[model samples]
Structures are given as structure tokens and as C-alpha cells.
Target: MARPHDAPSARELVAAVREFLERDVLGGLEGRARFHGLVAVNVLGMVERELDLGPAHERAHAERLAALGFDGDAALAAALREGRLDDRFAEVKAALEDAVRDKLAVADPSRAG
Candidate 1:
């Protein structure tokens, strides 16, 4: 009865988790309790979900590079042909994560406190 998905719907799943945590786990947030508390926990779950598959993603990247005959130590040597690894997929992904701190600060300025 469920439609197929190309990948796990992390956003929807995280949103649902947020709602669950807000309503059930913490329950009627009061006193010092805040909704933002759940954001930290839920965001970390999303981050860990991403990190847990990093090795697989790296392996796939290596495989692709190998298939393209750009591999191993030789690939490191030939890396200049593609130039700076700083902008490579892996680096871009890292930068995206780094950007999160800034974005979160923008979203919740008090988070900087």
C-alpha cells in the first residue's frame, strides 16, 4: 500500500520525530523546558544518519574513480588534473555541514549563547 522511495525520507522522518518528541517524550514543555531542546537532539540524529553512511559513500566514490581509471596513488598524482580537492564532493559535503552552524545561528540567534 505504500509508495516506493528512492531513499529514506529523512526530512519527513525527522519532522515526525520532532513532533513526537515535542508531544510525547518531553510532554507539555514547561519551566526551563524549550522546543529548541528537541531541535538539538533531532538534528543530531539526522547528522548521525548522514555520517553512518559516509564510508559507503566514500567506497562508491572510489569505485567510480577506479572505473574511470582515475584511482589509487596514481589518482592522487593525477588529482591536479581535476585540481583542488577542496571543492570535491567530499569537501563540498563538509562545507555544507559547516554552513549548518551559521544557518542555525541565523535561525536561533540565542543558540550562539
Candidate 2:
């Protein structure tokens, strides 16, 4: 996970772009262009959060699924749909909620509450 480079890591680079878009690009636009710039900023924010948390989130998700006797998300979905997790519904629900929150944290943490 280590980058063999010097200063200005990938996260820093993304953050710089997002900041530019927010401070410069958004200020010069109007109507649709402004909307598009806002969307771009949101996308960049998601990308930044993903870069920061994706690996850890995936590890936690896999661990949670395995603890419930599933190999991965697909397997977990199958079991849920087939009622295979009926006995552990509460536990599964909690795990799923946590996973969703983790994703929302990356997609838009402000709405996570």
C-alpha cells in the first residue's frame, strides 16, 4: 500500500483538485455549468474518501461476511434472499447497516447521520 514516490501523494493530489474546483471553478460558473462543477466536487470528495477508507472498509466487510458464514457480498446476498440468515437476522441487519454507513461515509459522510 506504500507509494514509492515523494511528497504530494495521490490523496493530496485529489484534494488539491477538489479544492481548486470548489474555490475557482464553481465561482466562475452559473446554472448548469455550476451544477456540473458541484457534481464534480462531490465526485472528487467521494474519490478522496474512497482512497482513504476503501481498503479498510473492504477488509471489515469481508470479515463481517465471513463471521456470518458467507464468503463475500454475493454469497451473503444469496443467503439473505434464501432465508438462510433468518436465525441471525438481527446480526446480519446490524452488519449490513454498518457496511452501508461505511459506504455513505465515502459517498457523503454528511448524510450519514
Candidate 3:
């Protein structure tokens, strides 16, 4: 038994549209239309990934910032620019790398590696 609202979650809807674009629409599109269609599909894929990964990523980012003794990105950036984190450069670098990897995971899994 499935309720109408319970079926086809937002992520599922995005996936369905992305699949349709990739499988049906892309083949029929040509020239600039095809290019735009591909772009739309890519954006939809990013949205799907964000829906799947955003919450976990948000938590991890906050944790990383806390572990680095910062409240937010602006604070962290200010500290770095002030050379306050120079002694802890390696730790900062690792945290930043992890952050970038997480972003890439949502933006483009292939590039996340």
C-alpha cells in the first residue's frame, strides 16, 4: 500500500526527469538544443546528488570547522589569512581537502576522486 504523497519523493522525481532527459530527450535533441539538454540533465543530476548528500555534508562540514576551532567559513578564512593557522597548516590543508572532496561529490562524483 502506498500513499500518493509518499510515493515519488523529490529525489525520485529529479531522478526520473534526469533519466528521461538522458534517455529520451537527449537523443531527439540536436545542435544547441542538445547542448542545452545535456546541461539541464547535468544540473538535474547535481540536484539529485545534493538532495542525497547535502545533509551529511553539512554536518561533516560543521564538524570539520569545529575541529579546526572555527565557527564558520569566514572565521576560518580570516584566521588563515592572518597566518594564525600557519603552525597548523597540515591540519587546515587536510580539512580543506575533505571539504573540497565533499563538494565535488555533490557537484560531480567523477571529479570527487
Q: Alpha-carbon error at 17 in model 1, in Å?
A: 13
RMSD of 1: 9.7
What overall lDDT goes with each candidate model?
0.55, 0.91, 0.95
lDDT of 2 by residue, 51-92 (tens): 999999999999898889888888888888998889998999
How accurate locally is residue 13 in candidate 3, as Cα lDDT from 0 to 100?
97
Clashing pairs in 2: none
Name the runs in model 2 displaced over 4 angstroms. none
Q: Per-prediction TM-score, please?
A: 0.31, 0.92, 0.92
- Report the Cα lDDT for residue 63, model 3: 98
Clashes of 3: 0
Error of 1 at 76 (Å): 9.7
In candidate 2, position 21 carries an lDDT of 96
Alpha-carbon deviation at 38 in model 1, angstroms: 3.4
Candidate with best lDDT: 3
Which model is ahead, 2 or 3, in terms of lDDT? 3
> Tens digit of lDDT per residue, candidate 3, span 1-113?
66568768999999999999999889998999999999999999999999999999999999999999998999999999999999998999999999999999988899999
Which pairs of residues have clashing backbones in candidate 3?
Answer: none
Q: How far in Å is the alpha carbon of 55 misplaced in model 2?
A: 1.6
